[model samples]
Target: MKSRSVIHVTGAMNMGGTERMLMTLLRMKPPWKSIFLTYGTGTGTFDQEIKDLDGEIRTIPNPGSLSDHFQLFRTVKPAAVHAHTLFQSGIPLAAARAAGVPIRIAHAHTTADPSDKKGRFIYEKLMRASIALSATDYRACSSAAGNYLFAGKSFEVMPNLFDPKQFKRPPEAEVLRLKLKYGWTDKLVLGSVGRLTKVKNHAFMLDMLSELHKQGIKAVLLVVGDGDQLKTLRRKAEELSVAELVTFTGAVEDPSIYYHLMDVFLMPSLFEGLGIAALEAQASLTPVLGSEALQPEADLGGGLLYKLPLEAGSAIWAEKAISVATDSHKGTSDPVAVPPEEVLKHYYQLYRWKGGGHEQKTADYII
Candidate 1:
């Protein structure tokens, strides 16, 4: 039988949970063929990840306007459409409705938009409308995200999936030993990965780092990912006198190699819809430290979860770090590891379901 075309639409082909999930779906052969949509023209880490997975990419740069949807509908004949990016949700959904796709899935990865309050509200309303208009179902990685995207609507949960196998710890692991090149050898390494932005609370992380130093804990921070706040964050590190200990790798492709170097992974963020970096680190078996505002405990099974003190001072924060780091697990300086095979199997099931459509679904359960 000819395979159905399962088209996925999104804003950017950036390295993120949503895009990674799509790449995973495209990796395995299923009853459906896959295509992608990007509002922007250029590509980054994701394009390579997709190509490595043997998937195809298509462009839809002008996806903001409804007319753009009409143009897209004419260009790609898709059996179904899955929207991974929030901004592009309404347009592709509207297009799917016009094209009469049987299954349209709105993939929500975050609890709320940490960008702006007004923006978050607007997107929430748009997502609701999109689901009501085009989607057969709504898929979320966490209840926080599901509740926000589907206010009155019902939603399903699919935990963030990571192929534990791809991150196999190397024999002569250089991810840690390389840190010595930056003088992080003697000091403990507390690592965090994500774009340096306000929501990530890099400033707060620096604050906590300073607190740790003042107490003579002898620790440093290794951050991955580059963004607008990179300069400001570096400045904060310098101002806090922790600059020598902090290293910003500026967004690498496979962070798992880096995850091996950490003494403890820290994610002190204002909020998180889905923390992919933390998930990758956890699957790599790195001990984690997260802000109370974000549910690190729920997502990460065994990790040191900390809350910013209500008093907000160097003393309290330092005390907290000491407590967590002492008990933290950092994956043992790159011990040998083989990733699980089911990472591919899990994705195969999803693609299989997408290709087969409602025919494979049991009508009797009616859930």
Candidate 2:
């Protein structure tokens, strides 16, 4: 019997949340083979890993013409096309419809885009219309993301699944090595993880560090991940005279290991479809202090998750951080138990569904 396959259309498979979720799916070795169709002709952080897992990676032009996508779909002949590029998903989904793919999915991963300009509104409207017409299924990481993208349309909320075992505390020697390497010994370590992008609100973390300094707290911040805002954030740290108290560790493949090094995890994102890092931190039993902008679903029933408004400013945020980190009960409560197989089963069920009937079950193509 021939094996079935699915194609996943997304931006560069970099270290972002969406990409990481896709990688998790691939690593799980689902029932079908996985193919990744990236938006441009460049490599991503996960490209090599995908290949090692017997998955394939192909590229289409950036904003590829409809005909280009249509032709690619025809050639690859996938059973499904799962598009993860937000409104841009409409184009490929339409092409998949034209190519007669059976399981066309539009997966929404964000609630908003700060960079969208007024002129792009028309484009979004048209693409959304196209998505409505073409997609056979709609899914999102959270209700907020689903409502934002599919508005009036019903969609499934697919939790971003991760291997909780990866988050277990590392050996004492390894923990000490990391602390020594980053000069974190004898300092209160507040950590944040994600790309150094504006929407992530990393600058607010710097302000919180500064506030902690003002209060005579020997606190230091460790920001993990890399992005365009690195230089800007470094400059902000210098301007605030908090440079010595902040350390920016560029992208790390296994950020879960670093979670053990933090006394408290901070997330001040302006918006999130679902905050995966916050979830990961909680999985590591690290208390999370997030902005109110994050969806409540991010809490994962963990007592360690705390939220406050960004309007309360860094002073209050710093105080909360200290309070949460210093509480003796911190790290005592485990995150809500989520069996990894149960999470993988959701994707398996989604992939196997085809609007009804066993006839479509054999046509296992995905994108």
Candidate 3:
């Protein structure tokens, strides 16, 4: 009996939220095999893990080229092509349609568009239409993403999966030693986890920290992740004169441990589909303050989560941050984490049902 293969299309399995979710799904140790298809090779930290799990990782050179997708589809002959990118998802999904893959899933992860120019907007609209037409099913990490990308199309909300056990561990002494070394013992330690990109609104975080300093509030921010905006954000932090108070840890393999060092987890993203980091923070029983644009679904029913408008000014956010940080008793019990095994069960069931009750679907699913 041959193993079933699923070609999961993604940007790169780097440190980004979407990529992290894909890694979690892969780590679920699903019954079927997986093929990770990215636009470029050797792009993510999970590449070695994918290989260790007997999964094949392929790169499609020139993602915009349909010929590249078609060749890979022919070679892999996947039963399904699940795309996780935004507007660009339609490209691979369309190739899947052309290749006759029976089960195509388009998973949305973000609510904000990177651009709004007229030409780009029209192109994205057409891309979304293609997604609706070519995809056999739709999935999103949150309702906001579903409404933004797959509106009017039936879709399922796939909760961001994480292993609760990983976060349940006590903080490492090394992490604590570093915190004490940095003199963060007495200061409120505000932390956030995400790429230092424009969409993440890291600049606003700096401004807020600057405002805190101006208000005579002693706080330090720990940013865990790196991106194209790292240099720009550092420059902006200097411009705001808060460079000394902000610590950028670049990329960390496991961010859950850092949550232990934070008094409050702040996500001031201009927009978010559903922040998995916020969920991770709550699972650690840490208080979270997010921009109003962040989806409320992240709040798993506890006083741990708070949201305020971006227009509310840095003073208001800093004030809320102080209160949340200083509270002796803030968050409720750790929010229940969606088990990776449970998520794997749902995905495998969908695969089996769609593949006609077979133990493993034949590659001929490409018809």
Instruction: Write one digit per residue (lDDT tens) for candidate 2, span 290-349.
Output: 987778778877688889999999999999998998888765656884666777766666
Which residue runs does candidate 3 get wrong by more than 4 Å? Answer: 1-3, 169-175, 353-367
lDDT of each: 0.66, 0.85, 0.81
Indicate the TM-score of model 1.
0.82
Question: What tens-digit string does per-residue lDDT give for candidate 3 at 70-171?
Answer: 788877777778898888889999998998777889998889787767799788888998898899888888888998998678889886777767766484
Q: Which ten residues in a row have the lowest lDDT in candidate 1?
A: 358-367
What's model 3's lDDT at 110?
88
Better of 1 and 2 by TM-score: 2
- Which model scores highest in lDDT? 2
Question: What TM-score against the true fold does each predicted structure earn?
Answer: 0.82, 0.93, 0.91
* Each model's total of backbone clashes: 6, 7, 0
Q: Pick the candidate with the highest TM-score.
A: 2
- Root-mean-square deviation per candidate: 4.6, 2.9, 3.1
